[model samples]
Target: MALSSLDEVRERIGKAARLAGRRPDAVTLIAVSKTQPAPRILGLVSAGQRVFGENRVQEAEEKWPAIRERHPDIGLHLVGRLQSNKAEEAVRLFDAIHSVDRESLVTALARAMAKSGRRPDCFLQVNVGDEPQKGGCAVPDLPRLLEQARAADLPVAGLMCLPPADTEPAPFFALLAKLARRHDVAGLSMGMSADYESAVMIGATHVRVGTALFGQRGTEDG
Candidate 1:
């Protein structure tokens, strides 16, 4: 029998889990669906994979809503940097937001969820690479930010980070796991196609994978 797409993903996920002494179900495989047409997503849903991640607010606004109507069971997660202006829409659409860093974004998401009568699960995006160009809370500032989120009754489920390019990711993932444990955070949503196994070893509960599973997302995108 041939390996279907979901089977391939399961195999990859299982391998990564086994290497880390974890069960396959311990990791939530966030199938990144950025720029793929809706039909492709629908096909994946038909195969019984339930969770999906998207990178852009506008793109989700355009694509997820219609698909949402048809497959209401599909869970949506915002896996990209989010602006304050887009926070409300993000809370409306996504089951979780994986990239929240600033106090302003937290305020926006909290307010939006307050009015909508629903709270979207969220994670603080940490800039583990300390790259000024990327979007994440600096490690030093994370405690204060996590405090603020809790003070505001925002159910911050965990922390998320992007490792800097050209480096091994173990240290960053280890630190993230430690932080998650210290705060009793529920998740560590790090790792992607290349470094996910390291993330699993370091206690990642959710891994956002795109290219290695979906065969590269969007033309000319890294």
Candidate 2:
């Protein structure tokens, strides 16, 4: 099957889980809705997706409020590089922030979280590939940043990493798993539409899948 709808994606989720020796519900599929129309998001929502992700804070600001008015209880995850200037908006919109990797952003998010009296969940984005273009904290520097976040009461529950595009993502995922364990954190958000099987094999607890579910997002969006 070509997998046109969210239901088909869920079935694929099941198959992927079984292949990984895990329960079908173990992996969370972040229906990436960045650049996708709101009606399409509603369609996926109707198709039984409670979790969705968006890349840019600005785009999310435009789309999420309208959608939330229609579905107030859905979980929204910010899966993009967030700037300190937009921290306030991100705090108000997302249930979780998965791309918090910098000291300034952590401080900003702390302020936002405190202001709302809400402890929003977060992930420490680790730059496992050491790519210059990426926005993640360097892996070697993650421990300090993670400690800083914890000290600031950022409610960090896990680590996230985007592996190099050219390499198999499994090794990087495995490394993040080890780093999380070393840091005593429980969540590892790695993997994507392409290498989720590799992610599962390496103990990824959450995978950010976009194209495999909702199809490829706009180049500028993801």
Candidate 3:
């Protein structure tokens, strides 16, 4: 793993937060550890990165169970599409889930949380760009989704999104912020390595950065 890259990204996050008159410490940096091996993840943990994001429940199940045993303070977030059947496992495994995008998921998660007595923070992903291929709830449906999640007793943390790739992301970020405020939610988990600074500047409470911290995907796995 690139150690200096972590420092550099933190520095960038701080700069962006300051530029936006927001506190640097307020923005959580979730190291996207999907496809990365344990040694690389430990290297980042050694450097004091306590929060990580994973793309799949099965992959994270393989990688994190042992790691969490050693570093219980580490937080794991699910940042990809979640199947309704895996809701219980996801509740048991992740500390926060950034892909609670549908009604079935909300109900499943609520049932799982009730059964397990654990509530991982939930983020309702919004398909801000309305990309049919994306995994988030459609923009017009966000309010209803949020209401369902809350009514189901899920811990609604905030909103998350992946902007239309290759387009400028600030406007989408702003729209998410507006929705969060309108709905009285607080967290905004947007941005990635390419555009995190803009995200922090636009009031992102969390940024999922992978490439800048871990280097290209699967390159350092060996």
Among these predictions, the greatest lDDT belongs to 3
Q: Give the poorly placed runs of model 1, Cα more than 4 Å off.
A: 218-222
lDDT of 3 by residue, 28-129 (tens): 999999888999999999999999999899999999999999999999999988999999999999999999999999999999999999999999999999
List candidate 2 stretches off by more than 4 Å: 1-4, 217-222
lDDT of each: 0.85, 0.83, 0.92
Ten residues in sequence with the least summed lDDT for candidate 3:
213-222
Model 1: per-residue Cα lDDT over 92-206, one tens digit each: 8999999989999888988998989778888999998899998999999999999889887887888999888879989989988888888789799988887877787778888
Please rank every candidate by TM-score, starting with the best.
3, 1, 2
Residue 194 in model 3: lDDT: 86
Q: Could you give candidate 2's per-residue lDDT for residues 7-41 as a string of tens digits?
A: 66567667777887888777887877888898888
lDDT of 3 at 12: 94
When sorted by lDDT, best at the front, the candidate numbers are 3, 1, 2
Point out the worst 10-residue segment of candidate 2 by lDDT: 213-222
- Best candidate according to TM-score: 3
Q: Model 3, residue 38: displacement in angstroms?
A: 0.5
Global lDDT for candidate 1?
0.85
Report the C-alpha displacement of residue 89, candidate 3, in angstroms.
Answer: 0.3
